[model samples]
Every structure is written in C-alpha cells, then in structure tokens.
Target: MKARAGGPDHRPPLISEHDRDAAVHRLQEAYAEGRLSHEELDESLHQVLTAKTHSDLASFPEENESTIAAVSGRIRRRGVWRVPRILKVESALGRVHLDLSRAVIEHPVVDIEVHLGTGNARITVPRDAIVDVEDLRTGWKDPLYKTRRRSRPGGPMIRISGTMGLGRLKIRHARR
Candidate 1:
C-alpha cells in the first residue's frame, strides 16, 4: 500500500466497503437507464465484485464521451478541460471534483448529473457563470453553493441534479 503524502500507508481503496457498493450501484444505475444490457451488467457486476484494485473499472469511462471524469473510481476534472453539453458523474467510494472555472462552455445551458455513495462531489465555477443547485441539496455546506441564479444575458448556466448517498455536494467560486 502506498502512503498518502504526510499520511499513513494507505490500504488499497478497492478493499473499502464504499468502493464495493459504489461499483455495483453505478452498474445498476446504468442498467436501469438502459445504458447497459443484461449481459453487460452481469459481466460488469462480476468484474466489479471480483476486482482486485480500483483500476479494474477503467472500462467505465469508455462508455460515453460526455463523461468528464472516471465513472467508478475517484474522478477529478480540472484545468482547461472541455465541457460537454451534458455531463454525468458517478463515484462510489471516491471523490468527484470538477473544476469548470477555466473550461470552455459551448452551450448556453449545461446539465450535470451527479451520483455518489459515501463520497463527495465538488464543482468550481468562474464568477461569470450562473449556478443553480436548489433542485439538489440545501445550500449551506459551502458559501458559494447557492440555489439562486446569477446570469448575465447569454452567459452559461449549469444545472446539477442527482443523488448523494451519505455524501455532500459542494460548489465553490474559483479564484479570478
């Protein structure tokens, strides 16, 4: 096990119960959404159940081009990454961080779906963009994460929704 910086030697994250449940839950969600066939779900579920490391879920990102980060494991999308029209992010036992402060937004309205289990998600946006998370969580976790809309004419807008089981959703303003 590799040690975290200034932290104790870490056991493989795959051994965590949250990771195990997250993997299965993600596959079930995909199956329910008609994104996975019966055979695929069965195969994927078997793989996840028997996975030795978190890397075993690499096949998930290949499922779609609209995904900004890893589908099953820890996901972090930062810097100048491209922003798609609609983004779906899922993490079971890990964290999901999307830094859209410098991302290129080609759409006036962007939709983001978040599903997490015992894991947290954070989205950072620039001052110019509008954020609306009211349909999701209560806005007290982070000062920047408000449900109110703040748009400037044709400025971009992001709509975030979905579930966070035993986790939190936070939004922060990026440094200008």
Candidate 2:
C-alpha cells in the first residue's frame, strides 16, 4: 500500500483497476440521475481516469450538449470550433468527418455518440488525447483504430460510442 499525497495515513489502501472502473460507473450513474451536469461529469471522469490514487479524485465541470445530423448530405466539422461535453452525431447516408485537432475542447472528457446508416465516419483527435471505443458497435466492418501501447499522461479522454450500420469508423491522432 502506498500513501496518498498529503494524507496523514502512512499506508493507504491500494487502488485497483476494478476500483477505478467502479468509480467511473458511479459517476456516470450520477450524471444519468441528473445529480451532475455534463461539465461536471466530464471533469469527474477526467479525474477518475487520470488519478494515480483514490484520494486524488474530486471535483467536476458544467453542462452543455450539441448535436449534428444529416439525412443524405455529408457531415463535416473542422477548424477552430468548440466541442461540447456530449456530442450526438447522426447521418443516414452521408460520410462524417470530425477534426478535433484544432478544436477548442474545454472539458476533460468528451463523449461522442455517433449513429450512421451507410457512409463511414472519420475522426482526427488531438495528438495527446486518449480515445476509447470499446462501447462502439459496428454492423459490418470493425473500426480502424490502432491502439497505442502507451499514451501521454493527463490527456483529455474521448469516448466514442453508438452504432455504425454498414459503415466503418476510422480514428487517427493528429500529427502536430
């Protein structure tokens, strides 16, 4: 057991991956129950994901949500745009391209929920951003995401979920 920073205890309880996961699940439940705002959830998620020990986890951010949908036209978002805490994107037949390399993302954690019918979706994340696509579901092809052996510490976490029907998801990290 390692002592937490600034704590009085000489030997603190050891933290495990299961513990971290439980914390994250509880935070999500809190958000779903309206006890926490989107921003608050983001901040809390970041802390939970990045915390080295249990004592370091605390605080949360505000609330904001955004959506992008298209029936047949291409859905594209690039340049210096603001990213909301919860972003919902839906497209029936158009390809979706989201470039977050140069976007303004204030939250520590961003959830991108995508629903596609036909065309593929491409997402370019920031160089140091941590991306998780475990919850993403595909109808045909698997997502084209090469996981890095190790990511930099304290990068904002991005979670991509939802369904991609008859289309694939391609994720790449920014070059710069």
Candidate 3:
C-alpha cells in the first residue's frame, strides 16, 4: 500500500558515508576559510552526519550503533553473510574485509572493532546503513579512507572503532 503524500517515507532514500563525508569536508573548508565558526563547524558536522535525505543534507548541509575479528591473514566477508551484533577484526599482518551490502542484518545496531598491526582493513557498508568511526587511536600513520553513512533515527547503525599501526583502514559504500 502506498502512503499519503508529504507523509513520512517509511524507508527513506539511502545515503552513504562518502556523500556525508564530502559534505562535511566542504563545511570544514568553509570553517578553515573563516566562513564559519568552530561552533558552526561542529554543529554542521553533526547535521551532516545525521541528515536523512540528500535534501536534508543540502540545507546548510547536510548527514551503528558490531562484531567480527580477523588476525594475521586476509579475511573477506560478503554475499549473504550474517553480520553479528558484535564483530571484531584484528590483523597483525594481514587484511580484513567486512562487506555488508549483501550481508544479513538482524539488529538495529551493530558494533565492530577493527584493530590492525602492520596490516590493513577495509569496511564496505550498504548505502542504507550508517557508518560511525570514532575514537580511532593511532600512534603511527594509519591511513583511513571512508565514505560516511549516517544511521537513520530508528534505522540500523554500524559503530566502528580501533587502532591502526602501520596499517590502512578504508570504509566505503558498495557499488550498486
């Protein structure tokens, strides 16, 4: 059954971390150029990260709450796999991939811990889910590339955190 016009879209159009990150990046640049205040930057970043639709993001905008573990080898997950509530992945000298485009999600929030040691880790998420990367500690240069996806108010959330040492962390959206 179709809902009424102007009403809430039960399943809002999906947004990706990449889209959100780009928006945030722009705001950051603006702040750096003295177009915005520190407070504005923080508030804008929050708005961008929480934006529901692209339009929501456009207005001054923009947009897991886990577990898997991988260590010392190349690990990949994809294609109809089951994503546990808590997944942790640790690579002492290898690679880890946590792809959720085709995975089974049975929770409103998922938590993931990605710890790398002289290795690499890549996380691929669905456009519909949000990607939250916070408190990532790294003493050495651990390059991290990601597409920021925000969790809808009541939708699925993916929380990611960890430490990377001489490793690279990449988080992006899967190709549709």
> TM-score of predicted model 1?
0.54
Return whichever of 2 and 3 wins on lDDT: 2
> After superposition, which runs of candidate 3 have C-alpha atoms over 4 Å from their true positions?
1-71, 142-155
Q: Candidates' TM-scores?
A: 0.54, 0.66, 0.54
Global lDDT scores for all candidate models:
0.70, 0.86, 0.70
Residue-pair clashes per candidate, as listed?
A: 0, 3, 29
lDDT over C-alpha atoms for residue 127 of model 3: 66
All candidates: CA RMSD in angstroms? 16.7, 12.4, 16.5
lDDT agreement of model 3 with the native: 0.70
Writing each residue's lDDT as its tens digit, candidate 1 over 18-103 gives: 88788888888776654565787888888888887877762442443375445466788888878876788777678888999898
Cα error, residue 89 of model 1, in Å, equals: 0.2
TM-score-based ranking, best first? Answer: 2, 3, 1
Give one digit per residue, the lDDT tens place, for model 2 in 6-61: 67775556668898888888898767644576877888898888877779765443
RMSD (CA, angstroms), candidate 3: 16.5
Q: Give candidate 1's error at residue 75 in angstroms.
A: 0.4
